[model samples]
Target: MNALKGQTLEIVQEEFANKILQIQGVGGFILVRNNGQLLASKTDMTTDPQTLAAMMILSSQDCKTLQSTMGFSRYHYLMVTQEKIGKLY
Candidate 1:
C-alpha cells in the first residue's frame, strides 16, 4: 500500500510539472487537497509550497462564503494580479 501511494504521488507530481511547463509565465504552483493538505507542488526556491497551499485554501473558502452572501449559487475561480505577481485558480 505504501509503495502504491508513493507511485501515485510520483505520477501526480509528474503531471503537475508537465502542466506547469506548458504554461508561459508560471513560475510556481501548488497542488493542494480540498482539506488544505499539500499534495504535490513545483515551486521556485523563493516560494514556500506549504504556506502557499494554506493561503489558497483559506482564500477559496472566503470566496465561497462571499459568493453565498451575494446570492451566487457557485464560485468558480479567483484571480489576483499585482505589479509583479499574479495568481489564478
Candidate 2:
C-alpha cells in the first residue's frame, strides 16, 4: 500500500474557493430560500466572495430536496450542469 500525504477536503475546497473559478467550463446562479435571496457567482477572472456564498445557499437547498426525495443516507452539496459545459462556438 502507498501512503498518501497533503491537503484535506476542507483544504482543497478552501484553495478552490480562494481562487477564481479554475474549472474549464462553468456558469452558475445562487438561489436562496427557494428564491433569489443572494447571488453567488464565479468565473475565470471574477473575484466576489458574497456571490460565491450565495451560490452555496442555493446549492444547499438543491441537495436537501434531492436527499429528501432520493432518501440519501448522506448529504452533500449540489452541483448542476454549468452553462459553459458545451462546445458550440
Candidate 3:
C-alpha cells in the first residue's frame, strides 16, 4: 500500500482544498486512488476517509458494471448527491 507523505501530501491537500473552494455547496471532498487508498481530503464533515474511499471504489465498480450491461460507453465522470452529502469522482 503506497502512502502519501511529507511535502507530497501537503501539496495534494492544498490542491484539493483549492479545487473545493471553487465549487459552491461543497461541504467536503476526498481524493483517493483507484484501489481505495486515501490521498487527501478537505472537509469539516465527520466522515471517515477510509470508509468513504472504499464506498467510492465500490460505487465506481458498480457504475462500470451497469454501463456494460446497458451497452453504453465509459463514463467521463460520476457524481452522487443527497440532501447533505455529495461526492464527485
Q: Best TM-score goes to which candidate?
A: 1
All candidates: TM-score: 0.67, 0.36, 0.66
Better of 1 and 3 by lDDT: 3
Better of 2 and 3 by TM-score: 3
Which stretches of model 2 miss by more than 4 angstroms?
A: 1-45, 77-89
Q: How would you encode candidate 3's per-residue C-alpha lDDT over 1-89 as one tens digit per residue?
A: 22256456567667657887789876677888888888777766666778878988998899899999999898887877655655445
lDDT of predicted model 1: 0.73
Estimate, for each residue in 1-89, the C-alpha lDDT of model 1 and write its tens digit.
13254577567668767887679977767788889988777766455778878888998899888888898777667776545454545
CA displacement after TM-score superposition, residue 64 of candidate 1 (Å): 1.1
Global lDDT scores for all candidate models:
0.73, 0.48, 0.75
Task: Give me the runs in candidate 1 sitting further than 4 Å from their true place.
Answer: 1-8, 81-89
In model 1, the worst 10-residue window by lDDT is 1-10
On lDDT, the candidate that comes out on top is 3
Candidate 2 local lDDT, 1-89, one digit each (tens): 12236766555544554453454544532223445443233334243545556566666677787889999866644444546543211
Q: List the residue pairs that clash in candidate 3.
A: none
